[model samples]
Target: MKPILLDVPLQLETDRLFLRAPLQAGDGDVVYEAIRDSINELKQWLSLFQTIPTVEETEIILRNAHIDFLKRESFRYLIFHKDTNEFIGTASLHAINWKVSKCEIGYWINTQFSGKGYMTEAVRELINLGFQQLRFRRIGIRCESTNLSSRSIAEKLGFKLEGTLRNDDLSADGSKLTDICIYSIIM
Candidate 1:
């Protein structure tokens, strides 16, 4: 089936959070603020913000993400607190393989929202969406082996650790090589 023909939910509700695709024109600013506030921590893992990005640049990326969502190439959602309507983080069902019904899930939360189990809950919902709603055969998550917090999230969700890719990629600072742990669930 052409993915664009697939019925994708515009929003997903958890107990305290709302997950939705980046469809609003002004949505990028909120995400940019979150990244700005969390850059010290985020830069340790993600190289996407190696340098702080301007609001305009972030908006462009968010706009492109919307296009990708329409094409069903990848699904990037901006997460928000249901009650407060505050942006909490971002997550994506990316690196899709429509034929195999597989996709990789990635996420990052604002530092202030960390340790609250928000991301864990968000990821669980994505897993359900991927397997039951999206009808995917496999869902995988890859993270740096040294990132215990991220690895723990996958374990908590009952995703099995497939293996560690040694020297799989560069460290966040690009100063050295790092190992990556791949975890997956197959339906």
Candidate 2:
């Protein structure tokens, strides 16, 4: 079979944010520190976040991400503050099931930036990328039910709440089980 050409060199800009490919060498550290410093504030909502990774590990991770990007198997973007040029978060279109023409959106923002509508704006741009450029048939988001902000963003963006997976996932702190709210936008 021929290789799938799924790369898109798209840099999206919102009023206060810049969404671009996660290509820098230390981009993971940029993301790790942003979330590490606010672990307490974010643990409740961001489940994939673990303890702060050392700079070395983050560098390796970032390098690997870039390699994966070239292979067209995954696409991850670092969300940066346009004014400050600071790495603020990460959003990914991964688990791409091409046979179905669908992908899942995963995102996390720094706690300080929460409640500011930044992620919502960023996610909308991601959806546009999926639909317009990637030509995906559907895009989906999954978040913890208790995460009101994520749920609100999904709902506001016209994602239908497909169902709730009871105790489907673990919280970031690993002390509690959380329900996964699956939301999807069908194109």
Candidate 3:
């Protein structure tokens, strides 16, 4: 069956968060601002933010995300504070393997929202969505071994450590080799 025909929700909510696909046309501006505000911290882990992205570029990305969501190619969600209606971070179910019914999750929080537990809550919801709604057999979180915050989120959510890939990739800055930690929860 074509993935595009798969029925899925565009949004999911928690006590403090509202997670949704980039359906709003103006969401790119908001996402761009969050990236600008969090660039320094984001650059530490994500190679995508090594250079500041223009608003137009961010918008294009968001538009693509919307298209991807419709095609069921990948689901990238924008996180917002429920009460405040503030953008807090980004999360996604990417690296999909439809045949295996699995995907890897990735996330980043706005620097201002760090340590607030919002991301953990958001990711927990994503895991649930993957298993319950998407019928995934496995959901994984892969992070740089040095990123304690990222690793802890997976651990906190009960994802077991599957293995570590030494020298899995380069650091965001391309200055050093980085190890990748693989954690997963299987149904």
lDDT of each residue in 1-187, candidate 2, tens digit only? 3226655765788889999886765676677688677777676765444566677776777677677767767777888899989777778787788778899888878878888888888899889888998888999999888888788989988999999999998886788888999999989
Q: Write the per-residue lDDT of candidate 1 for residues 131-177, one digit (tens) a residue.
A: 98899999999999999989999999999999999999999889999
lDDT against the true structure, each candidate? 0.93, 0.80, 0.93
- CA shift of 155, model 1, Å: 0.4
Which candidate achieves the best TM-score against the true structure? Answer: 1
Error of 3 at 111 (Å): 0.8
Please write out the lDDT profile of model 3 over residues 29-129, one tens digit for every residue.
89899999999989999998999899899999889988898989899999999999999999999999999999999999999999989999999999999
**lDDT of candidate 3 at residue 72, scale 0 to 100:** 90
TM-score of each: 0.98, 0.89, 0.97
Clashing pairs in 1: none
lDDT, candidate 2, equals 0.80
Q: What is the lDDT of residue 84 in candidate 3?
A: 92
Q: Count of backbone clashes for each model?
A: 0, 0, 0
